[model samples]
Structure formats: C-alpha cells, structure tokens
Target: MRILVTGGAGFIGGHLAERFVIDGHDVVVLDNFDPFYDTRIKAHTVERCRERAAGGDGSYRLVEGDVRDADVVAELVEEVDYVYHQAAQAGVRPSVEDPRKYDDVNVDGTLNVLDAARDTGIERVVLASSSSVYGKPRYLPYDEDHPTTPVSPYGASKLAAERYACSYSEVYDLPAVALRYFTVYGPRMRPNMAISNFVSRCLDAESPVVYGDGTQTRDFTYVEDVVEANVTLLAEDAADGEAVNVGSTDNIEIRTLAEEIRDQLAPDLTLEYEERHDADADHTHADISKANDLIGYEPTTTIREGVWKFTEWYRNDRDWYEPLVLNS
Candidate 1:
C-alpha cells in the first residue's frame, strides 16, 4: 500500500514511516520541518527512513510542505492509500504562550487534511490526538466516552481536530480514526518533553527540574506501541469514525520517572521541583480497551524498558541528539 504520513520527520512519525517501509509499503512523508525543535533531527529521521527503505521492497519520499497547504494535502491524499495525520504544534506549555499558532496548525491544518481526504476519496485516515483532551480526567483511565474538557490550548486544538475527523466521517462517509496518544517516550523524542528532558539532564550530570512536586502522573506509552496502533487502524474497518486511546495502562508519577532516569544515568543528581504550569494536567491514564477491541492494540514496552532503550540510543547511537539547555 502507498501511505502518506504527515509530520513523518518527527519522532513518532519517523518511526511509523520506517515501520511501514520495512513492511514493504511505499511511504511518502510530509513535513514542514518547523523550527520548534531543530530541523537537523528531522533530517536525520528522514535519512534513517530512507536507509530502512533501501533494504526493503518499499520506497520512501519526503515532501517538504506544511499541512496548512490545502493544495499540497489534497494532492498527497489523492495519491496515497491511507493518511496518518501526525503533524501539529505539540506541547501544552508552549501552546499556552502561542495559542494562535496552535490553532492555525493543529485545528485549521487538520480540517484541511480531513477535507482533502474527504474530497479525494481516501480509504482511511488515522489522526494523532492527545490524552490532554480529557483535562484533569473526571474519571481515572479515561475512556472514549469521557467528556473532553481540555485545559490547554494544545489540548483544545487536538479535540477540535478529532471532532472534525468524526464529523467528516459521519457527514461524508469518510473512514477516519482518531487515536488519543498518552505521554509517548522513546529514542528520538522531542527534547522539550519531560522524559527526554530528564534523561538528557541526568546523562549530562545536571539536575533535572520537575514541576508541581513531581506528583503528576502520566500513562507513558512507548513510541513503537503508538506506531503499531496507527498501523493497525489503517486496515481496521470497525475503527472508522471512532476515537481510541493508544497508551500503556501503566501510570507513573513524574517524580518516580525522574528518579528512574537519575538512577540509570546520574545516581547522585537531585531533582529540583517548581510550580506546575497552568495548562498541564495533574494526571492522565488511558483506557485502551476500545483500541484492543477494534485493532488488537496492546502496549508492549514497560516504562523501565522504554527508558533504558532511550538512554542507550542517546548514549551510543544518537550522535545527533544534542541536549537542549533551557533557562529556568
């Protein structure tokens, strides 16, 4: 099958693209290579995907463009058998500072993708949503039926995108599935995220900063599991027009996560705690029963295993991963 992966140069998107290539599917990656993080990392991601494709029966192509470009989205949608929409202005805190950019890229860009898919008769679209849409979670282990009261602009935009996907599916009979991802972490993770930041800081023998006493909990899903969910939904007929959670059922406190990283990399480093960001959720856990039922999705990586893998990559493999230093 010919697959189009939006934001395919980022962590999850890059891994997903490589998997599709190894599975003998032709893949086209669309990314604007936004400067939110370094574009060099994304370049490396594309290079790795191309290398993987070289040994397989599949081919890979990179189309440098923004999802907001309707013409580009339509043209890509018309050519691909399936669309994996992963492009967005990620991060809750950053979105709080620049809500309009989030709205423009996450919401309007998603509408463009869905509209293009609908117009071109694309078979299926797998959207990358977020657990943040559930806000503080009125109930533990948020299910698909849970109300979406997002606390952050990023979450709100993601919710809006998911709603648009559902609406497209209902009104135009488009086959679209929105997968609400939890706190995904692994090698090639964005440097701004908690796990990545902690791991990098620990490796450098620098004290990592934690917010809100480090009591906040998150169901940290591995990138491979997240990619597998998207791949599974691509062919799942029953998942059409449905939103499902893609996450590990395991939830861990932020303090525990920092401790784990410290134990592995910097045993003597002490963590510094600060006030939590207003847009940040206190806790998040996903009920992935719907994903299991529809697409046989199950998270295979434990937090310890995932963190170890990421550390290994950072130390021995990821020569390009430079630790980002942020002002406190």
Candidate 2:
C-alpha cells in the first residue's frame, strides 16, 4: 500500500509514518516544516523513517510542501492509497491570538486534502480532530453527540475540518473518518503541551506550573494507540462519514499529572500554579464507545505508564528539542 501522511514531520504524524514504513508500505510524508518548534525534530523524523525503510520492502519520501496548495496536494493524493491529514496550526492560545492563520491551515488546508482525495478516489481519509471541539464539557466523558461549542479558534477549526470530512463522505461518497483526539502525548510531542511543559520543567529542577488551581483533568492518549486507531480505519469501511472519539480509559487531573512527572524526574521540585489561559477548556474526557463499536479501538496505555515513557524519551532527546517558547 502507498500511504500519504500530511504533517508527517510532527510527533504523531512522524510515529504514524514510521509505523507504516515498518509495515512494508511505501509512504510519502507531506510537510512544510512549519517552525512551530525546532525543525530539527522533523529532520530527525525523516531520518527515522529512512531507517525504517532501509532494511525493509518499503520506501519513504519526504515532500516539502504545504497542504493549502491544491496542486501539490492533488499530485500527492494521486499517488497514495490512503490519506492521513495531520497537518494543522495547533494550540489554543496561539489560535486565539491569530484565528485567521488557524482557519487557513486547519480548515482550508483540510478542504484541499478532502477535495484531492475525492478526485483521486483514495481508499480512505482519516482526519486528526481534537477533543477541544467539545468546549467546556457539558458532562463528563464527552460523547460524539456532544454539542461542539468550542471556545477557542483552534477548536472551532478542528470541528470545521472534521465536519467537512464527514460531509465529503456523505455528499461525494468519499470514504472518510474523523478521530477526535484527546490530549495526545508521547515522545516528540508538541513542546507547548501540558505534559511536555511539566516534564521539561521537572527535568530542569524547576516547579511544574499548573494552570487554574490545578483541578483541570485531561484524557492523555498515547501516541501509539492514536496511531492504531488511524491504522484500523485503513481497512474498515463501517465508520465512513462518521467522527469518533479517540482517548484513554480514564482522565487525570493536571495537578496529579504534574506531581507524577515531578516524582519520576525531580522529586525535589514543587508544583507552581498560574491563572488559566484564556479560551482553554475547563476539562475534557472522551467517550470512545463510538470508536470501540465502529472500529474495535481501545487505549492500551495508562497515564502513569505513558508519563514514564515520555520522560525517558525526553531524557534522550533533550538536546535536540529546541522549543521556541517557555511556559506555553
């Protein structure tokens, strides 16, 4: 199979591209190497993909392009069996500052992917949606039917993208599924996320900052499981025109997460609390029953175990992860 992963240089995309290569699928990674973080991480991802393909029957190609370019996206879609659209401008606060950029990258960019996939007759298109679309949870463990009242532009963009995928599937008979990811965390994750910030601060012998009195809870899904969810959709057609939640079995409080990472890396450091950022969700927990029933998906890693794995990976890659901003 020939697979195309947009934003394949980023964390989850990188991991997914590598896995596809290992599975002996010829893979093409489409990315613009957006300097949201250091571009070195993306270079490293491409290197890892090369390593995966070197001794296998698979091939890897990295195309330096933007998804907003319809011509580039069309050409790439024509050569692939499946499309995993992971490219986007990610972050709540940043999107609040610049909503139009978010719209251009997340909404318009997604339209390009879906349009190309429709024209090329791709097997399936898996969109990377976010739990942020649920807004301040109406109830615990948000279901797929939860009303999407996103407070931030980032969340609104994701909701728009996912809905477009669903609409494409329905109107154009294009096979597509949108997975609403919940606080995904693992090696090489976005440096501005909560887990990364906590781990980085703890490693530097500084207090792990907690926002909003440390009571906010998040369902931190492991990257591997998120990858599995996408891979499962490659062969399953029952979920076409649907949006499903991809998340862990449980939620952990921000304070608890900070404490756990601190205990693992730097027990001497205490936690620090700051006022919550504007447009941030109060809490998020996903009801993945739709994913389970539709695609037989299940989260395999717990938060505690995942935190350990992330800390270990960060320790090794600490030298290269040059995050642009601190206290994100």
Candidate 3:
C-alpha cells in the first residue's frame, strides 16, 4: 500500500507514519513543520520516523510542505493510495488567541486535501478529528451522533473539516472516515498540552498549575491505540463516510491524573490551583461502539497505566524537550 500522511512530522502524525511504514507500506509524509510548538520537537518527531524507516524494509519519504497549498497537496495525492489527513493548527488556548490561523489551516487546509483527493482519485481519507467538537456533552459517553456545538475555534475548524470530508465523499465518491480523537497522550504529546506542561513543571519541582478545581474529567486515549485504529480502518469495509470516536470509555478526573503523574515521576511535587481557564471543557468521554463495529477499535491503555508510560517516555526522551523554553 502507498500511504500519504499530512502533518507526518507532528506528534500523532509522526507516530502514524512510522506505523504504516513498519507494516510494509510505502509511506510519504507531507508537513510544513509549522512553528506550532518548538520546531525542534517537530524535527525530533521526523527523526524518530527516519529511525524507523532506517530499521524497516519498506521505503519512506518526507516532503516539507503545508496541506493548505493546493498544488502541493494535489501533487502528493497523486502518488499515494490512502490519504491520512492529520495536519492542523492544534490546541484550544492557542486557538483562542488566534482563531483565523486555525480556520485557515484546519478548515482551508482540509478543503485543499479533499479537493486534491477528489482530483487524484484517492479512494480513502482518514481525518484526525477531535472530541472538542462535541463541546459540553449532555450525555456521559459521546457517540458519533452527538450534536456538534464546538466551544472553541479549534474545535469548530475541525468540525468544518470533518463536514468537508463527508461532503466530498458524497459528491466526489471519495470514501472518507473521520475519527474524533479524545485527549490523546503518550510519547510525543505536544508541549502545550496539560500533561506535557504539568510534566515539565514537575521535572523542575515547580508547582504545576491546575484549572477549575481539578474536578474536570477526560477520556485520555493513548497514541498507539489511535494509530492502530487508523490502520484498522484501512482494512474495514464498514467505515466509509463514517465518523468514529477513538477513545476508551473510561474517564479520569484531572486531579487524580495529576497526582498519579506526580507519584510516578516526582513524588514530592504539589499543584497550584488557578482560576478556571477560558475555552476549557469540564469533561469528555467517548462511546466507541461505532469504532468497534466498524474497525474493531478498543483502547488498550488505562489512565493510570498511560500516565506512567508517558512519564517514563518524557523523562527518557529529552531530545523532544525544548531546552531554550524550559522553565521559561
């Protein structure tokens, strides 16, 4: 199989690209290496993929480009069998500061990918959507049918991208699947994320900041499971034009998660509570029934287990840590 992964140098995208190549597929990664996080972190992600490619029998390639560039997208779409569109401007707090950049990258970039897929006759597209699209869910486990009332520009832009994928599937006969990834963590988590931020603070023995009384819950999914779900979708016939929730049904409170990290990584660390952050949701849990039915997707990591795993990786993977910004 020939696979084209947009944002292939990103946290999740890099992992996904590595998995595809390891499975004997020819892989091409397209990423602009946007300064969303430290470019060094993104560069390290690509370096990890390069290591995998060096170790594997299958061939791999990386193209430094943005998905918003229609010409670049179309050129790459012409070379691959399946298109995994994972590139987007990420993070909620950052989106609040600059919403137009989110719209341009997440919304317009998705449109570009879809149009290129249509023009090139790519059969399948797997989009990395987000649980933020569900907003404050009225129910416990958010199903694929959950109403999408996005609270942040980042979520809104992602929802728009998913809609575009579905629309293209209908109009251009391009089969597409959108997976709403919930609170994904583990190796290569973006530095701006709560887990990464908290871990960095803990490493320095600084009191980690907590928002909203730390009672908010999240359905944190591990990155390996997310990669497996994407791969499973490629072989499943039932996923066409489907939106699946890629998450464990389990939920963990923010305080419990933080304490677990502290105990595992820095036993003496304490948390500093702050006023609730804007654009932050109270809770998120996913109903994976659709994913299970379509792609046999099931999360293999619990919150406690995942936190330990991520902490271990964070401590060992100093190359991913931004030295200049440390304690800044």
Candidate 4:
C-alpha cells in the first residue's frame, strides 16, 4: 500500500514510517522539519527512514511542507492509499505560553489534512491523538469513554483535532481512526520530553530536575508498539470512526521513571525538585482493551526494559541526540 505519513520526520512519525517502509509498502513522508527542538534531528529522522527504505523492496519519499498547506496536503493525499496524521505542535508546557500557535498547527493543520483526505478520495486516516486529551483522569486506567477535559492547549488541540476528524468521517464519509497515544518513549524520542531530559542530564553527570515532587504517574508506551498499532489500524476494516487508547497497561510514577533512568545511565546524578508545570496531568493510564480487541494491539516494552533500550540508543546512536544540554 502507498502510505503518506505527516510529521514522518518526527520521533513517532519516523518510527511508524520505517515500519511501513520495511513491510514493503510505498511510503511518503510529509514534514516541515519544524524547529520544535532542532531541525537537524528531524533531518536525521528523515534520513534514517530513507536509508531503511533504500535497502528494502519498498520506496520512500519526503515531501518537505507543512500540514497546514492545503495544496500540498491535497496533492500528497491524492498519491497515497492511507494517511497517518501525526504532525503537530506537541510540547505541553510550551503550549501554555503559545496557545494560538498550537491551535493553528494542531487544530487548523488537522482540518487541512482532513480536507485533503476528503477531497482526494483517500479511504482511511489514522490520527495521532494524545492521552492529555483525558486531562486528570477521574479514574484509573483511562478508557476511550473517559471525558475529554484537556488541561493544556496542546491537549485541547489534539482533542479538537480528533473531533474534527470524527466530524469529517460523519459528514464526508471519510474512514478515520484516532489513536490516543500514552507517553511514547524509545530511542528517537523527543529531547524536550521527560525521558530525554533525564537521560541527557544523567549523561552530563548533572542533576536532573523534577517537578511537583515527581509523583505524577504515566503509562509509557514504546515506539514499536505505537507503530504496530498504526499498522493494525491502517489495515483493519473496523477501525473507522473509532478512538482507541494505545499504551502499555503498566503505570509508573514520574519519580520512579527518573530513578530508573538514573540507575540505567548515571546513578551518581542527583535530582533537583521544582514546581509542577500547570499543563501536566497528575496521572495517565490508558485502558488499551479497545485497541486489543479492535486491532490486537499490546505494548511489548516494560518501563525498565525501555529505559535500558533508550540509554543504549543514546550512547550508540549519534544521529539521534545531539541537541540537548540537559542541565542548564
């Protein structure tokens, strides 16, 4: 199948693109190479995907453009069998200061992608939603039925984009599925995220900062499982109009996560506590039963295992982590 993955140059997007490409599918990546962290990292992600595809039977192409560009999105949609809408302004704390930019990219940008898919006769679209859309879950193990009272603009925008996609599915008969991703972590994870920050600080033998006593809990999902879910969603016939949670059922506190990383990287490094960022949720545990039943999705990496994997990647893969000076 021919697949077009927006934000294919991003951490999660790049991983998903490689999965499709390795499966002998024609893959086209649409990315703006946004300066979210460093354009160099995004460029490296694209390069990795190209290299992966080059040695395989599949083909890979990169479309350097924004998801907000209607003409570009429309043109790309016309050439693909499926659309993986993963592009957006993704940082939570940053969104608190720049809500409009998040809205423009996450909300308006999504609408443009949906429009392109609708106009171009693409049958299926897999959207990359976030667990932040659930806000502070009133209950443990957040399910698809959980109320979406997003706390940050970033979460709100992702929820808004999901709604827009659902609306398009209803109004335009565009087959679509929104996968609400939990905390995704792995080798190419974004540097601004907790795992990357902690790893970098540890590598530099500096104390890593923790916010709000670091008690917040999260269900960290691995990149491979996330990519697998996307592939399953793209191929399944019953995925349309469904919003499923994709995550490992295991939940760990932020403090636990930091400790794990510290143990794996540099146990000598201490932690500095700071006030919690308002945009962060207290706890997030995805009830992935829906994903399991619908698409046979199951997370394969444990937090301890994943932490080790990430540490190894950081040490070995020079192509992934060159931008961060974790301790300021």
Candidate 5:
C-alpha cells in the first residue's frame, strides 16, 4: 500500500508513518515542519522513519511542504492509495492568540486535501479531528452524537475541518473517516503538551505547573493506541463518512496525572497550581464505542504505564533533548 501522511513528522503522525513502514507499506510523509514547538524534533522523527524503512521491505519519502498549498496536496494525493490528513496548526492556547492561522491551516488546508482527494480517485481519507470539538461536555464520555460547541478557535477549526471532510464524502462519494483523538501522549510528544511539560519539569527538579484547581480530567490516549486506531481504519470500509472517537477510555484528573509523573520522575518535586486558561475545557472523556464498533479499536495503555514508558524514553533519548535547556 502507498500511504500519504500529512504532518507525518509530528508525534502522532510520526508514529503512524513509522508503523506503516514497519508493516511493509510504502509511506510518503508530507510535513512543513511547522515551528509550533521545535522543528528539530520533527526532523528527528523523519530520521527515525528513514531508519525504520531502511531495514523493511517498504520505502519512506519525506516531502517538506505545507498542506495549505493546493498544488502540493493535489500532486501528492495523486500518487497515494490512502491519505491520512494529519496536518494542522495545533494547540488551544496558541490558537487563541492567533485564530486565523488555525483556520487557514486546519479548515482551509483540510478543504484542500479533500478537494485533491476528490479530484484524484482516492476513495479513503482519514482525518485527524479533536475531542475539543465537544467543548465542556454536557455528558460524560462524549460520543459522536454529542453536540459540537467548541470553546476555542482550535476546536472550532477542527469542527470545521471534520465538516468539510464529511461534506466531500457526501457530495463527491469520497469515503472519509474523521477520528476525534483525545489527549494523546507518549514518546516524541510535543513540548507544549501538559504531559510533556510536566515530565520535563519534573526531570529538571522544577515544580510542574498545574492549571486550574487540577480537578479537571482528560481521557489521555497513548500514541501507540492512537496509531493502532488509525491503522485499523485503513482496512475498514464500514466507518466511511462517520466521525469516531479514539481514546483510552481511561479518564484521569490532571492533578493526579501530574503527581504520577512527579513521583515517577522526581520523587521530591512538588506541583504548582495555577489558574487555568479560559479556553481550556473542564474535562474531555471520549466514548470510543463507535471506534470499536467500526474498527475493532481497543486501547491497551494505562496512565501509569504510559507515563513510565514516556519517562523511560525521555531519560534515554538525550539527542532530542540536548537542543533545549530543561531548567532554563
């Protein structure tokens, strides 16, 4: 299989790209190396993909380009069997500062990808949506049927992108599946994420900042589990034109999660509580039954296990960390 993964150099996308390559599928990664966090991390991800592909029967190609470019997206879509549209301007807080950039990339860029997929004869497109689209959930474990009342520009952009994908699926007969991923964390996590920030701070003996009262919870899905859900969708046809939630189904309080990380990485360090951002959701719990029914997706990583694994990686992988001063 020939697969195109946009934003393939990012955390989740990188994992998916490497997994596909290891499974003996030709993979093409298109990433602009967006300066959201650090481009070096993305570059390292691409290098890892190259290393994995070197030993497998599959091949990997990295194309440094933006997804917002219609010509680039169309040209790449023409050569792949499946398109995993993972490119976007991520981060809720950052999006709050600059909403137009998020719209241009997440909404308009998604349209470009879908339009190209439609123009070409690509049947399946897997879009990366977010649980943020649900806002403060009226009910626990948000399902696909939950109302989409995005509280942030990031969430709004994702909702718009998912709508565009579904619209293309309906109007052009292009099969599209939008996977609303919960808070994902694991190896190669971006520095801006809570888990990564907490872990990094703990390692540096710095007090990890806890936003809000810390009672707010999140359904933290491991990166490997997310990759599994995405890979399963490639072989699934029943989920076309539908939105599904990809999560671990294990919701944990932010404070609890921070304590776990601190205890595991720095037993002596304490966490500092701070006011939460206004755009932050009080909670995010995904009802992943739809994903299970559609793709037989089941999460296998617990919070403790995921944190341990990430801490282990962080301790051993010094190359990716050397560029940034942890305590500074």
Candidate 6:
C-alpha cells in the first residue's frame, strides 16, 4: 500500500506515517512545518519517521509543503493509494483570537485536499474531524446524530471541512470518512494541551492550572487508539461519507485529570483555577458504538492509564524536547 499523510510530521500524523511504514507500506508525508506549534517537535517526529524507515521493508519519504498549495497537494495525492488528511490550524483559544486564519487553513486547506483527491483514484481519504463540532451538547455521550453548532471558529472550520468531504463523497464519488475525535493526547502531543501543561507544571514544581471551576469533563482519547481507528478504516467500507466518533468511550473531570498528573511528582501540589474561555465546552463524551459497528474500533486505553503513560514519557522527553518547546 502507498499512503500519503498530510501533517505527517505532527503528533497523530507522525504516528500514522510511522505505523504504515512499520506495516510494510510505502508512505509519503507532506507537511509545511507550520509554526502553529514548535517546528522542532515536528522536526523530531520527521526524524522518528526516518529512523523507523531505516530498518523497515517499506520506505518513508517526506515533502515539506503546504496543503494550501493545490499543485503540491495534487502531486502528493497522485502518488498514494490512501490519503490521511490530518493537517489543520489547531487550538480553540487561538482560533478565538484569529478566526480567519482558521478558515483559510482548516477550511480552504481541506478543500484543496478534497478537490485534489476527487479524480485521483484514491482508495479512501480519512478526514480528521473533531468533537468540538458538537457545541454545548444537547445530551451526554454525543452520537453521530448530535447537532453541530460549533462554539468556536476552530470547531466551525472543522465542521465546514468535514461537510465538504461529505459533499465530495456524494457528488464526486469520492471515498471519504470523517472521524470526529475527542480530546486526543499522547507522546509528542502539542505542549499547550491541558495534559501537557499540567504534567509540565508539575515537573517544574508549579501548580497545575485548571480554568472554569474545574468541573468540566472531557472524553480524552489516546493517540494509539485514534491511529488504530484510522488503520482499521483502511479495509472497511461501511463508514464512507459518515462521521464517526473516535474516542475512549469514557470521560474524566478536568480537576481530577489535573490532580492525577500532579500527584505523579508533586503529591502535595495544589491545583489553580481561573475563568474558563467562552469557546470551551462544559463537557464532552462520545458514543463510539458507531465506530465499533463500522470499523471494529474499540479504545483500549483509559484516561487514568493514558495520563500515567504520558507522564512517564514526558519525564524522559522533557530533558531534550523541553528546551525546544520553550525556545520555539
């Protein structure tokens, strides 16, 4: 199999690219190395991919480019059997500050990927959607049928991008499936995420800050589970043109999660709180039954376990990666 992973040098994209190569599938990664997060983090992921390819039967190649460039996207899509569109401007708070940038990258960049895949005989294009599309949920454990009233520009852009994917699947006979992800975290995750921040602060002997009274809940999915969901979709056809939840099917309160990370190193450390951002949702839980039915997806990592695993990785990684994250 030949696979093309956009944003393949970031967290999830890097995992997918390396996994595909390890499974003996030729993989090509396309990323602009956007400074949205630290470029050094992305550089490290690219190096990981290269090292994985060094001993594997499959080959890995990276093309440094932007998805917004139609010519670049079309060229890359033409070379792959499958497409994993994972590139986008991420972050809710930042989106609040600059909505148009989100629109241009999340919306227009996605349009470029979908449009390029239209006639490329691509087997499947897996779109990385988000649970944020379901604003202030009408009910708990949001199903595929939940209303998509995004509260932030980031969510709105994801919703629009996924809608375009569905339209292309319907009108252009494109095979695309949108996976609406809950809060995803794991090794090499963005440093600004709550888990990352909490773990970092605890390591530095600082208080873990939780905004908005710390009562909110989140269905945090581990990166490995999300990678499995995408890989499973490679052989399944039942979910084409549909949005399915890729989550752990469980949730945790913000304060509880913060404490869990804090206790790993600073059992006596106290948690701090502040007013929550308006764009933040009070809670998020996913009904992953649809994903199970469509692609045999079942999350194996619990929040407690995931947090512990992340903390362990951070303890070792921060020695080298922290300086880059801080400098960047």
Most accurate candidate by TM-score = 6
lDDT of 6 by residue, 216-320 (tens): 999999999999999987899899998889999889999988888888778999999988899998999999999998899999999988988988888788887
Worst 10 residues of 4 by lDDT: 319-328
Candidate 1 is scored at a TM of: 0.96
Deviation (Å) of 16 in candidate 1 = 1.0
Alpha-carbon error at 71 in model 6, in Å? Answer: 0.7
- Colliding pairs, model 1: none
lDDT of 2 by residue, 258-295 (tens): 99889988998989889998787778888989899999
Candidate 1 lDDT, tens digit per residue, 208-327?
A: 889999988989999988988887866778889888899999999999999988987889999998888788898999898988988999899988888888778777754567544232
Considering TM-score, which of the candidate structures 2 and 6 is the better prediction for this target?
Answer: 6
TM-score of each candidate structure, all chains considered together: 0.96, 0.97, 0.95, 0.96, 0.97, 0.97
Instruction: Give the winner by lDDT: 2 or 6.
Output: 6
Q: Considering only N, C-alpha and C atoms within 3 Å, which residue pairs clash in candidate 5?
A: none
Q: lDDT score of model 4?
A: 0.86
Q: Quote model 4's TM-score.
A: 0.96
* Greater-TM-score candidate between 4 and 5: 5
Q: Could you tell me the lDDT of residue 279 within candidate 1? A: 84
Clashing pairs in 3: none
Model 4, 201: alpha-carbon shift in Å?
Answer: 2.0
In candidate 2, list every pair of residues with a backbone clash. Answer: none
Which model scores highest in lDDT? 6
